[model samples]
Target chain A: MIEKILLLTVAVLLSGCVNLHVHFPDAADKTAGGEVPTRPADAGGAAK
Target chain B: MLLRTAVLLLLLAPLAGSAAQITLSLGSLRHPSFEAEGVMLSFDAARLGEADIRLGVLRVAGTEYRALKIHCSGFYFDGRRLDCPEGSVRREDERGRDRPALPFSLAWRAEDNFLSFSMHDVDAVAFSPLVKRLRSWQPKGTIDFGLTVEGDRAWLGLAVRDLEFASREGDVSGKAILLTVAAGAEHRGGAWQWNARLDWSQGELYRAPWRREAGVIMEAAGSLSETTLQVGLVRLDVMGTGSVNASLAWDRARGEATEWGFVTERLDLASAMDEWVQPWLGTLDFPKWYAAGHARFSAEWKAGGLRRFYAGLEDARVADGTGYVELGGVNAQIPWEASSPTDAEISVAAGRLGDLPLGGFALPLRLDGSEATVKGLSAPMLDGRFVIDLLRLAKRPSGWHGEFEGGIEGVSMPKLSRALKLPIMAGSLTARVPRIAYEDDVLRLDGALAIEVFDGGIIVHQLRLMDPFGKERRFIAEVTARNLDLGMLTRTFAFGSIEGRFDADLHDLEMQNWQPLRFDARIASSEGDYPRSLSIGALKDITALGETGQPKALERVPERSGFSFGYDRIGLSCALRNGVCLLDGVAREGEGVVLMRGSGIPSVSIIGYNRHIDWEALVARFREVIAGRPGAIIE
Candidate 1:
């Protein structure tokens, strides 16, 4: 049981180590660590 | 026999002089007259069919008498013939002061070596407003006969420099400073050499109506023909503040079907160059060359509805917080080809709004259609699709409809307070509306808005609004601000800060008599639910209300959620646009019912003050405040 608990802890630690690879259009990559703004598809509201 | 020979020699001597000999070089030229070393110089005499000059060149300090002023008849063409000394010039200085010669007529002269002519009383143009403004005017300058060759195939070239004159209206009172003018020209031909060229002291005029200073460069070139004349290249920096790079070309054919075409690099529905140059359109017949910077094409012209006014604008950056009506700058871009008024298409890119000093703001706009009409007035409506807190309308209209798309980052509550010209809770917002409509000058937005306020600031995550005008009165929205620093909002508007949180909305607001009236808004600052020195200072700039308490140990206390909010005296007031707001009532304190009704735009004044209320019972009172009515009191 103690070994199992140790394995679970290691798995949790490794999960945070997972690197996320993201690609974006040139315009969206203007700055690092920032989200690009996007316009609404139409003037209609979401409910419509 | 000797006497008869002498008479015959004298008679035959004059006949040998038609050899087009070199004449005296005229020294200098002044108004009404100039001196020629050889024959008398005059444009008036030349106009009488064919002018003739009789003189000789002062070569080696000698005059052989070879040039002839044959009149092909008149001898000495007096200055009166050319109306030189007697010629009166018109003035371009005053508005309706009865000064006629604004665009003076061109004058000229001819001689053996040098000839000169002068043009005075040239009209100086003035733009609109207090600054220098002038009507239509022709550039005024002089032409000098630099080097004149006479071999029937003679060539005439004038240095054409240092030609000084005014191109702007002269103020009668002041030493009418005119548009500084300087230019030069040259021409060569046999029977008739047509030559004229003009250049400016400045490079070019590219400024908008909102811009203070402007400059422009214009050039026109063409050979004179008895019939079927051709129009050369001409350009007008239409916006006075934008680019006038279009290419307009046309050709004249003989064997048949009159062919003409035009093209452009970037075509706008309402052309900036065309509008500026249209005044001169009637003066000269030119095939519309809308595209001056790019392309090669041409089309026929036709007339349509409301040619002049194509777009209606609502610019409000000038008077932040003033309900819609007080527009700062107005511009209308009509759907007309740069060169041709008919049979052409124009496109509108984006326009910036906030740059006007009166209401400085930046708004980049894009137009969708080539044509749009407001109340039957057709104009090139700009496809506006930009984010808010960026730009604004220039003209405050009775009604409006617009849609633009752009992004505004990092807009804070304090800035919004200053822009809206009012007080509010602190927060930041990043918002965009697909469309915004204003009818009767009331703003109606049809879109969605998402916001997050952290650290005493209103933050916008995403906001979209637009109104197409359909069922479901849609809704005019306003956010409720709580626990905000009223001081920040006031200072941004240059009105100083007040202390309070505003839980109020103008409720689909608009201007009535230039005043923005709020039907309901319940506000209560911990330190002031009533009239405080801060509120009074913000409104009337008076520091005679409420106490100025000294800072307590809690002054350094960090913002804590548990220490969230505390109630104080409640107060309300009627808002006025631009500036001014009437108190809804006298400063009221404690637990009291604030009655509101549709009474003459609603009035406010403090009635009484109360203290010590049961915590459980006060919840109902809070609901009452939202309803703008006296709530149930179990005091």
Candidate 2:
């Protein structure tokens, strides 16, 4: 009886999760095409 | 005819000489509608009555125009046209800073009152004098611009292909900005009316001030008429994830009163927070949390501050870096205006809070003054619902204060254990709380919550949290459990089988950074008429209880080989303070405490000799025993 109830609750919870999606992808993947142009020396204080 | 030509040539000789010399000086030179001072013109005469003209330094409106050289092939006035065939202007300010020369030709037709100058490859470096007055702004790179004036109307156009701007002590920079502006203005009735179009493209604002480069593009059109400036429309794109459309109008005659509105659609929350929010919250410490959603924002301002604001969110999700707290399907519509009342409903569909699965909760909220009232909400918990009554929250000068009343009814304990990542236990858990309040960064509960498990009742009281959101969180509580079946607790933890009832109390219990701070706790066998049985495994572990002893304290105990015993009672206690546990038991004989007292056949008793033990080491021993990794016992 306990196992049945546990299975039922799990089913309900899983069914409600149809819309859930992992929103954060890898940062490196999102920035893939090298969009930022190289800063000139006058742009100042580039990271060493 | 011969007599007439001789007479005309003689009369024109001196006038031709003066035109060839072309020298003039005036303390004040006045045109029909304009005036100037200290004007001087000089040039060299040519044999055929042409000249090379030089206009010297002159002062007008506090700005000085330096010498200008021009070559005039023909310098005579004809039908209101004074034309210069070829010329070049050396741009300079009063301080004599030289810029590159722009070669051009000029013509002025006074009959139509139009002046047109055409030049090729002009540089805007001469505008540095005007840009120097702005704070923390510098323009670097080349710009090409042009100007044309016709009567009282003027037209100016400028464009720059790439430029770099930096701020924040040179740590923040933006590059490769394509900018263009075209404007036309006409002066009439002592006021100017103008319209302009501005375009910016392929721009990226970069580095330290931001964690990464943020790309941007914008296009806008605006007009200025009389004392009112109107912005027709502005379209902006950010990070390829969102777009904004906005418009504004400001009345300068009325203390710059402004009305503006904007709509930003479908902005990725993670990038938005990283680009626009985190830099301002540099002092706060929190785990890396990611979010995604669409948020619509609008606001109105007058008299230099906010008058009304609204925000709407849809399909929003926020999660911590550790994957512990994730929420989905968050939606809300909130509106606030000065001294006005508003109400909203926030809902979440399904997600996990810490380790507990949470779903289908809606909170109805009403705000007035600086206080908000939450009119209860229910969330699914295991097989039941956790319900909260009306909660009140008020913002004060220090932080935020809030209070609520809630309880859980018949939540499945075994599943809850799994959610809480705890040892599995039987039965169910239920709780009732009269009140919980938060103020000055502390959360306090005045009443007790009861958990029904192990066929027992555990009551918790005086629960409090200090710095609940800080790096080091603390939980303080006192608890008492009565008539607990020891067999259930032992079996749940797999700590060997024991059949009996017991009672326990924990007083002044405090946990800081998730470790015990100070507590006086005791557990003893309860008085009952029930069969008391202990397995050999239980006897061995119990016999190992000593201040510094390992889990397998007595390796060769009498009941080591699958033997069982019947015990009359057992008791243990510890006064944990200052990182140490002062050990005690039901009785003390000699220098040791008798932890267990045996009564019948195969009876066994255990004694602990040491009194003071490191709390952490003692906990490690308990964990090892439960993990079935008890080390060798001492002789």
Candidate 3:
């Protein structure tokens, strides 16, 4: 069961990376745009 | 033109024949690539002599340096060329403090617009403007660099020491970095063809899930156009890790990689997982994993998605740090393509999941896009064979979903029980799980799982598990067991001996994290014409289950030659809710419940006076009974 979960997690993580859209923080204004990239909403749960 | 004007003005200066002092001042000078304001120069014209030059502001390649000063003790000039053989450059801080001077050399030829400059031990922060153009991180350290430009070609050599940098968001950061970079570029066809090499020997870096700690070298050849950057090949070698060869095409305007692919040399799986993969699993409630062996991996990304991926594992072994799961002697070749179906195979020598030891098995798999399928996968499981006739899984935007049909056959009950740390039991268990499905984070059984054991059958119905791998995992099911021999059950559990057959019904059973939360449970002697008897020890244990200080009928029974009694029937019921159980027995007798009724001579009735008991307390008493500490007396 754990092996299966690990495999599923790898697949999901890869898919998530494929769809990732990076937003670089604005260099001119440090406080204006310094947010970590958003993670998928459903990424919190175990891979079912 | 600016250099010509300065030279012309110096030639017209008064010369004292043998050694003449010449000073030239320009309010401002400008060129396509360079600009300076309030420039001043003083030097001897007859021979090589001391020279001092200062500029209020100097701009080169879109970067500005203010309050810059250069002192050359051996400056020479001839017709159309100028040289600063030995010099030092300094910049005044905002508070008017002169920074430490850095040694430099300069040579220029106005004949063909050729220039060369080198500086050593220069503060890396002074080059923030150039670094900012490439990334938003702020750098601090020292650098030694040289640049040469002739026509439309340029060469650069840079070495940075003790560099520390971080982006404002902290997603990218490095510390104590020591590296050397050499790059060259030539303009051709309105673009720059560039090749570069970098050797990094020290530093720890964090760019989200990618971290590096020293010993890395990268060599790349690429072209940069106005809207795109293309790398023909990039070879990255990481010390003590592995190497990767890749190519990429990036759209500058879109700030995205249009296409990229990489193939890794056989990589050490243990190190790779710790360095690159663990961070992606941040804070997850998963067992830490340790891996061994080597694997080759390749992947391609195109059109903004992963197009293909392949992995070949060579005798790999992965184990859970918590000792719950392990796979040893595993080898597999897995290939997945977005546009086509592929076949893969994997073999394992031995494995374990929790307490169940697994035997070697090989499986064939098929992959197509986001779906995977397996047919007829079987493995030896604790004296039985676990067989999955078919398994299918698909990845959807909503999440992952899957289903499988499997069964456990001829598994020894004693072995299973011992493996699971349960009491030793007789007989073997066989179960047929028709279908199990997973969707929306829930795993459910479509049909019942019937396990035959102890000359009886246990049927589990309506089984559902929520968030099976999450912190708040929950399991719900209804179970029924028929005609289980009480003699075997008692002996197995170390409970006081009892004879006859019994049936149990457990409805609406709910458990969170494997702890019972709520249930309606009933156990009764099977209705049959059979001898029913309970040992004196069992009677004491049953009576002890009543509420503390509650009087029980078993106290009146006198000692007899045979330390046992005959009972007509036995029954008990408990409906649990909110940590409490509403208890009942076969029939109510006055203020008590008839747990056992007398049947023959010397028989005694057993009654329970408590109708409400704490569930935990009841379980504690049951454990005590099973452990042979009856905690009750009959005098």
In order, what lDDT does every prediction score?
A: 0.30, 0.63, 0.74
- Cα interface RMSD of each candidate: 25.9, 28.4, 28.1
Could you give candidate 2's per-residue lDDT for residues B492-571 as a string of tens digits? 77677888888888877899856888777777787668877777676555544333333332343344545566778778
Model 2, residue B124: distance off in Å is 9.2
Between candidates 2 and 3, which one is better according to lDDT? 3
How should the candidates be ordered by lDDT, best one leading? 3, 2, 1
List CA RMSD, all candidates. 21.8, 16.3, 17.0
For residues B1-635, what per-residue lDDT tens digits would candidate 1 score against the true structure? 22332344345444333443322223322321122234333323223323333333222112122222222322222232221222322222355245332221222333322333333432232111111233333333333332232322223333323222333443122111223322232333411223333333332232331111224444434332322323344443323334332222232234222322222223342333345443244234321322222222223332322122222222211222212222233332323333333222322322233321123223234222332222111111112122342223332343343333334444565554444434343555544544444444344445544444422333221222222222212233443444454545444333433444433333233323323322223344333243232332222221111112222322333333322122233344332222222223223334432311111111112221111112122333223322322221111
Identify the superior model by TM-score, candidate 1 or candidate 2: 2
Output the lDDT of residue B456, model 2.
80
Candidate 2 pairs with clashing backbones: B552-B633
| Tens-digit per-residue lDDT, B311-345, candidate 3 | 98889998866566788999999999999999998
Error of 2 at B356 (Å): 1.9
On TM-score, the leading prediction is 3
Best by lDDT: 3
